[model samples]
Target: MTAPTPIVLLHAFPLDHRMWDEVAAGLARTHEVLAPDLPVALGEPLPEPALEHAADAVAGAIRATGPGPAVVVGLSMGGYVALALLERHPELVAALALVDTKSTADTPEAAAKRRQVADAVQEAGSVDPVRAMPDVLLGETTRSARPDVVERVTAWIGEQDPARVSWAQRAMAARPDRTDVLRAFDGPVTVVVGDEDSVTGTDAAEHMVAAVEQALLVVVPRVGHLSAVEDADAVRSALADLAQRVHDPVA
Candidate 1:
């Protein structure tokens, strides 16, 4: 049998490759998976968080996996980097899965907020911008019942490198609207969002799903921005279906 296509897993902001650990482990049973730490979150010297630079870094990782395109799965900021990857290296993507993310650029107000957060991180040397994020990142059900999930999210936010967090903020602020890029992609696309996600929500996912010619929208119930962590089974199943589509495009 031909080898399954590689799957490149991109993580959300203020978090490292660990966010995808559970999902990746499950997927690894039948596929070659590469979960890369985005440049800023790697705990090394912070590079200016340019979206293109992050894309380039991920592209390099993908290339190292071997020849041919790979399925790219990105969440939130990782979704932005995934779009950037599609922009920078279209031929390297076999399929695309965007979770809890949008294809639009940040609004001016949002950009300003990002700048403010970046400045605060720079001055305080902390990831305080995400201090109260569990409420925003998790849904009512997850928050009320999954204390383990909530604690892990909080700990992940706390362990972030401050300088890298600031860089990630600036990089996100610089991303452009990628709806046009989606419109141009001919490969399969999957847009997944939590029904209760306050960050990007259903409308955002719908917009991208509508833009892509061969795209499907999946709204995971009782979850918020972090669907993969909050509802790993649903996400893992969605990704498995997407991978099947990649292998059998006619189906």
Candidate 2:
């Protein structure tokens, strides 16, 4: 008889573990949830139009924290890192929960934008890019209902080390598309999105669910790309469902 495994939460770009405060409490009732911040960005100027290093950075975090395989929950940039973690250390992740993110690489145009953002963050010595970034990342409807969520999210991003912020941008811009990660995983998977999420819509969530035979997708209406914080209840319920699935794969 072994104790239950913990649930692991990975934070999005320019954010630390704080992003999952609501989620951590929600999941704690039944499952142990651990949230680790992404590395603070610092160091050399970002590579032009590329951001592959963040993946490696995230993989290191996963390996260091786990005593055994843990259910991995990742949001936005965190989701990208989760994909890379699964690819690099498959045995460490028992399941994956991807919220408001897709498993695809950046397009050339998207990559270029990433570089521009990195440069701006580096020059300004701030996470303003991350703060302003959500406008495009999340939907307009969300901003209308949950003004606090923006502050919460922006704070997470703003606190980031400018280099970490810049580095994360570059890392994301450089990584390969991860659709295959979804297509290949056989374990329990949860794909959640805010109904109002125009950045990565429900369509992307469904594609991920379809890719993994055992995957489940939950859409939180009136919520935006930051579904975890925007609709904590929806996220909690979904995690509970995922926990049950992991606990009883045959069911």
Candidate 3:
């Protein structure tokens, strides 16, 4: 039998590959999984973590995953990088799974907010703004019932390097609309989101699904922005389903 295609996992802002630990572990039994720690999470200096730069880096990592097309899975900021990779190197991707992310560019007001956060990080020498993100990161159900998940997310945000956080903020602020990229992709696409995700909710997922001819949308109930961590099983199932589609296009 042929080996399964590799699954390249791109992580979100201020978080490392650890965000996909459980999902990767579950998928690893039957697939090759590549979850690289993005530069922003490595405490490395990034003058500007532009999506193009990050996408190039991710492409390099995907190329290193052996000689075959791979399924690309990304969340939040990772999704932006994924779309960039799709635009720049579609040959490397066999399928795509985008979780809790949007294809729209930041509005002027939203861009200003991101720049302000970047500025604050530079001024305070810490990711203090992210430290207060639990309310925005988790759903009310997850916050009130899943203390462990909330704690894990808070810790992840707290551990982000101040400079790297600033770089990510700037990079995200500069991202462009990628709906065209999505519409052009011919491979299988899976758009997953948390029902309670206020950051990029059901509407965003729906929009993405509409843009991709082969896209399916999965909504994880009682979760929020960090759906993978909030509901790893559901997220993993979505990825596994996409992996099947990637490996067997006729199936």
Best by lDDT: 1
The deviation in Å at residue 233 for candidate 3 is 0.4
lDDT of 1 by residue, 147-188 (tens): 999999999999988887888899999889999998999999
The whole-model C-alpha lDDT of candidate 2 against the native structure comes to: 0.76
lDDT of 3 by residue, 45-119 (tens): 464558788788888887877778799998998999899999999999899999999998999999999999899
Sorted by TM-score, highest first, which candidate order results? 1, 3, 2
How does candidate 3 fare on TM-score?
0.95
lDDT of 2 by residue, 1-251 (tens): 55466787877666788868888897888776767666423235544333334445555555666567778888888888788888877877788899998888878999899889989988988777667866765567767776777777766666678877777778788888888976888889999998888777888788788888878778888878777877778887887777677778865
- The TM-scores, one per candidate, come to 0.96, 0.87, 0.95
| Deviation from truth (RMSD, Å), model 1 | 1.5
Which candidate leads in TM-score? 1
What overall lDDT goes with each candidate model?
Answer: 0.89, 0.76, 0.88
Q: Which window of ten consecutive residues has the lowest lDDT sum in model 3?
A: 39-48
